[model samples]
Target: MSVHTACPVTTRKTLGQVLVCLGCCCGRTDKGHPPVPVDWLKSEWKRRMLPKKIHLSISGCLGPCDASNVVLILYGQEAIFLGGLHEETHYLALADWATDCDHQGCLVPLPESLEPFRLERFVDEPVAAGAA
Candidate 1:
């Protein structure tokens, strides 16, 4: 839960400027890879949220291996999925949708190529909920 770290106190940060930071957060697998597209999507939101520095990384796995093909968006405010996807198109669509999300909690809708991988909803604290 405490995966995200505050930037150096002396340095400045913004809301939108996020870094996926690789395994700064984590999943359960030994091969923990922060889902790339979701992380990429979050970083793009810096312009809108003006995070000054939005930070994204893989946190612990929200289980339900069924949901292993999952992702968190907007620092867990919303979660979505890679729906029957492979890394290439999956990451691209996620980044597109998340970064373009507006204040209304609505994302700009997924790209045509990624239409297949969109998940309707992401279960909360999926790991605890027994996502498998």
Candidate 2:
């Protein structure tokens, strides 16, 4: 489930900087139902009229199974992962954050409402995982 697009030659000139990754397993339901929020997110993006530079993608797997419905936002050198977003307010916050980041030239601190959804990527293996 991968789709690639051709970026324009002058991509750097765009101030809209966001890479939204709707990773695999995020939309899965408990009883093998259809995805939860993928369509809704897409609709919100269209409704909000976000910039074209803010690219949206449907990725295969993002290494965090528990954190389904993940959205990866790339601002400057930072990659912010927001998971478990299933509400309209969450979608709105994403747009707001991306717009602010684009104007600010870097990733600003996330709003208080979005703070809990932030996911810290695993850096290293735990020392006590029964590795003996």
TM-scores of the candidates are 0.39, 0.62
Per-residue lDDT of candidate 1, residues 1-132 (tens digit)? 575776455855322322232333333245553344544455555444534333445444443344344544443334444433446456655455545553434445456776665555644455855566
Q: After superposing candidate 2, which stretches have Cα over 4 Å from the reference? A: 1-10, 13-23, 30-36, 101-107, 124-132
Question: On a 0 to 100 scale, what is the lDDT of residue 127 in model 1?
Answer: 80
Task: Encode model 2's per-residue lDDT on 75-124: one tens digit a residue.
Answer: 55457787777666876787776666656765567888888988887676
* Leading candidate by lDDT: 2
Question: Once model 1 is optimally superposed onto the true structure by TM-score, how far is the C-alpha of residue 122 displaced, in angstroms?
Answer: 8.6
